[model samples]
Target: LPPTGPVRPDSYDFSFDSYFSGIGGSGFFLGDPKLLAPASTAPTGAPFGARIASAVENAREGIADHIRSSIGGSEGEIAAALIVGVRAGIPEAINESMRRTGIYHIISISGLHMALVAGTIMFLLRGAFALFPDFSSRRPVKKYAAAIALASIAAYLVISGIVVAAERSFIMLAVMLVAVLFDRAALTMRNLAISAIAVILVSPHEVVGPSFQMSFAATAALVGAYAGFADYRAGKTTAPPVKRSFLKFLSRKLAVGVGGAAVTSLIAGSATLLFAIWHFQRVSPLSLLANLAVMPIVSLIVMPFAVLSALAMPFGFDGPFLYVMGKGLTAMIAISAWISDRSPVDAVGLISIQSVLLATIALVIA
Candidate 1:
């Protein structure tokens, strides 16, 4: 190996590496310019990891272009993933879509996207399985579908390499899977406890990393928020949806996405401040608004192509879909770049690690 600081291979928590690559990519692509100096654009050509990332990204680009063309096509889930999974090569129209919305880039796949993908697939598979009465009526297909969902999620985790989210999602899913496989009803807290214990035992240091802390925290908060929303939507009075006009409807969506982006940025931003103060010296509150506008498109448009592309390539019939997906994903990327290039985002400056960590702890507790 080339002479350098002792190799601190963070392999113990590969999940961190996955998440770092994701947010780090976003930081490089859309983050404030002052954050990255000469090294920001350093070409990691020919390195093993770079090669792998490139191959995957190249596939993502193909899938994205395909999705863009075949608006309604086979493997639309994968098409969707490409935009969310890899935002590096998005084009124009998708970008415009986001600019109109006003949130963050939707490239980073999280619990929301995962749940959607899983839910979509489960429904699809369930419908398919139902066609065959024997399979449909035999045993609870939900368990088998859940296992398939777990497998699909694993594929996503590896492909996206989203560290913290992948790890935690995998663990939680695994717990659920065990219960399903054994035909036992699961207790959520008990499963969660097992996952937590497994995570620490596997990599104690992950407790200090942004991926570990932030992923868990965000998952918990979102889950809580979603539960509240579900209950409220069922009957209780809650925050009313913005009144809908054609133009106003669009604005409300953008506002909703921006709101989500703000929450995400605050969580992810705090993690960054704790782990790498030198890299991020200030925080930009407006980033949430920007993110909110853009993120929905990224999730709905850009990232889903990874799986979609893979699904389409087999019969050599994927080219057209790939082209469309690529175009849309590329459009999404181009918009983010355009926005970054023009009225680029600015930061609020960095905080001390201790302060960041303390804030993180507080957020988690709350």
Candidate 2:
């Protein structure tokens, strides 16, 4: 090795290093790591990859600066995290609060980010297509929208630096878009399986990481739960053609929204419970309650406004949107703080391996 510090192979996380070696990369570098001044632009005559990376970095930094100016606090950091999938500036106190409340994933680019962005793109594109009635009526406008949404998501994946969690979400989103093209179900177990397999093949070590394990475990449990209950839901829905007054329709829609939120929180929280305990040495007992209280705001208000803010930044119109997103995040922070305070005793010790193995067998049998 070139002029390096003392050999520190023991300091490396062996599993991570092993994964790197498995992919034909050296886990250790040959020289002392360099500390350099930050450059605002691409290096002179850099290659294509370097240029694209620099542009993406600039875009992210621009978003971060805008958030700093408009929101300007931990809330602003949260906005940046949600908007650009960057979490570099959040305070440790707030981070722990979120983790304790089980909302830290909101700061990461996970399935929720992919779903919100792709869903918004699809909705907008389809609505725009529908404006031309003659053309929309004749063409597969939905499929066209799906294709465009996929392309937009791909661009986002590149912008987000294609991290492991984002990569998994992108694969799942791509599979769903392709299913749209073929007139098939999008959010099914098969798609989940395919995405999981793709991620495993690309980064097998990710299967051992918290991001991969928790996300896939939560998703698989949700899929299986829904599949098991599908027949009952279908039977109940078979008699749902009755005409209703506007008030009743609104009430029913509200009920569905509330019920869906509760079920989703319960399922995702329970599914990831073991992983949480194993990794963090504790579980958020009120995770479902926290998610139910905060996520709709994050999904319906924060994420949409954040996307709009990012898009509007180049035109100097992002301020109001960023302010709105900060307001939503402030509410989320308050909720997290409340939960953390009220449920101080919710944390538990780490689960034993034997118990985990037994639970795994039981889960499989179930």
* lDDT by residue for model 1 (316-339), tens: 676654565556644555555565
The prediction achieving the highest TM-score against the true structure is: 2
Write down the TM-score of every candidate.
0.57, 0.86
Scored against the true structure, residue 135 in model 2 reaches a CA lDDT of 98
TM-score for candidate 2: 0.86
Q: What range of 10 consecutive residues in model 2 has the weakest lDDT sum?
A: 3-12
User: Which residue pairs come into collision in candidate 2?
Assistant: none
